[model samples]
Target: MPIGVVKTERSIVGVACLIHKDWTLRDEKIMVVNLNIGSELLCLVIANGPNENERAEIQDEFYEALQRELDKVKGKFILLGDLNGR
Candidate 1:
């Protein structure tokens, strides 16, 4: 899980956890990015998965974490991700 963070003048975004999906763990990738624009915060996560169940689980957890972080922050925040739950 490679988590990367970036900060901007009014926003921050980055990617994390490039897990490859393969029989031998050879080709899977996951990305997470956080953005802070002015007094607002946003997060975007991109994940690769050949397993829908696992993907859903991971996405759920990720969203929870994002919400938790946003709650602790002192500003408006928005979280976005392809949970693939739908």
Candidate 2:
């Protein structure tokens, strides 16, 4: 199905997916920027969620989660986030 500006808000907030005319996958930290692009797809995997956490303890869990989400991606994708900056 086609998708739009699907977003989720909470401790971790972001656009779930911006499907101009299609939907494929989405969950928690798994954000599908474009479900399909001719034959490729783009996704932003978030583990720490956001930079507004304010907490100084968030590494192991974040990295672990990030790796897990990345594994779920099928073919093509991209990951965005500040590691040391956080």
Candidate 3:
């Protein structure tokens, strides 16, 4: 469940988390990256939530963690990934 961001040569980007542990959970289900594209700062998050078949607690924890991460962002952001929700 590794997550990443790809850019072309002309793109300007900065990664907030250079190490995997700094950006993702133990399960590697979620990842966050703070990027500086030119003068604009963006908080980019990629997540993979547990499926419907997963346990309730797992689902709860995933949503809670996701919310906590989003709450920490101070500026503009884009959340894109498979939430595994209905």
Candidate 4:
């Protein structure tokens, strides 16, 4: 699985995310994200594996989605995540 998230705040920024990769023969991808408006925090997660092709695709898709989400926020922002795009 692959995921990415971003957060924004008035004076501070907080971003969080995760990524998991497998070492098996088969390939799989998983992605997740969480946005906490009250806490002013964004969480992202990325889990991918088995090969480089799948990793690259996950990374590409993640960035695309991440950027789109970031555009909706304002003020100081933080972007963080573990994108297993290896």
Candidate 5:
């Protein structure tokens, strides 16, 4: 399965690309992609199951990173990603 994920609204579900599969896990489940809809900037992230310490460091880090990326875009962006609460 793809480690990182970028969850998007159903409107843009028809278009997407799977890339940097390995890049997913290493980069804290973060994936960057070009969403050429209304906006040309997007990123995909996927969170892993809860690790020790009652939290997943990688997922947490990716969430933080996603925020930074969003700040850079500073426009209408689609936040697409998967979170494993269980």
Candidate 6:
């Protein structure tokens, strides 16, 4: 699965994750965006997790990876996307 973010003109003051390789999982299932909004910092995460049909191990790995990203965020954040879980 792929992920992305769309922002209005001049809405984002700066992008902290410029390198895709550093912010996204190897399978491209998760995308982390650290945005500079005015005087505040926001961590925006878009994730596509393994569906119910997928192997349990794969699902576990996805959640673990997601947790790792969340742990790295220090301030205000928003996580929105298809987790693929029931």
Q: What are the lDDT figures for the candidates, one per model?
A: 0.41, 0.49, 0.66, 0.40, 0.45, 0.67
The C-alpha stretches of model 5 lying farther than 4 A from their native spots are 1-16, 19-28, 38-59
Clash number for candidate 3:
0
lDDT of 6 by residue, 1-86 (tens): 22233344332222233444435433456777767779998878877677788898988998998898888889998987778744
Which residues of candidate 2, in runs, are more than 4 Å off?
A: 1-34, 46-57
Candidate 5 backbone collisions, by pair: 5-45, 5-46, 6-44, 6-80, 7-80, 7-81
Residue-wise C-alpha lDDT for candidate 2, range 1-86, written one tens digit per residue: 22233344343333344346543345444343435567667655533253545464654555566677677777777665444433
Q: Indicate which candidate wins on lDDT.
A: 6
Query: Candidate 5's error at 79, in angstroms?
Result: 0.9
Q: Write the per-residue lDDT of candidate 4 for residues 7-39, one digit (tens) a residue.
A: 332212122233243212111233334456585
Minimum summed lDDT over a 10-residue window in model 1 is located at: 21-30
Question: What TM-score do all the candidates reach, one by one?
Answer: 0.31, 0.47, 0.66, 0.34, 0.42, 0.67
Could you give me the TM-score of model 1 versus the true structure? 0.31
Q: For residues 2-78, what per-residue lDDT tens digits would candidate 5 score against the true structure? A: 23345543332122346634222334334445444453544443333233444567557746766666566544555
Over the full model, what C-alpha lDDT does candidate 1 score relative to the true structure?
Answer: 0.41
Candidate 3 Cα outliers beyond 4 Å, as residue runs: 1-27
Candidate 1 residue spans exceeding 4 A from truth: 1-51, 55-60
Over the stretch 1-86, how does candidate 3's per-residue lDDT look in tens digits?
A: 12243434222222233543434432355668777779988877877677788899988998998898889888998987778743
Sum up the clashes in candidate 5: 6
- Each prediction's RMSD to truth: 12.8, 5.9, 9.7, 13.8, 9.4, 9.6
Report the error of model 4 at residue 62, Å.
1.3
Q: Predict model 5's lDDT versus the native.
A: 0.45
Ranking by TM-score: 6, 3, 2, 5, 4, 1
Give the distance in Å from residue 48's predicted Cα in candidate 1 to where it truly belongs: 8.7
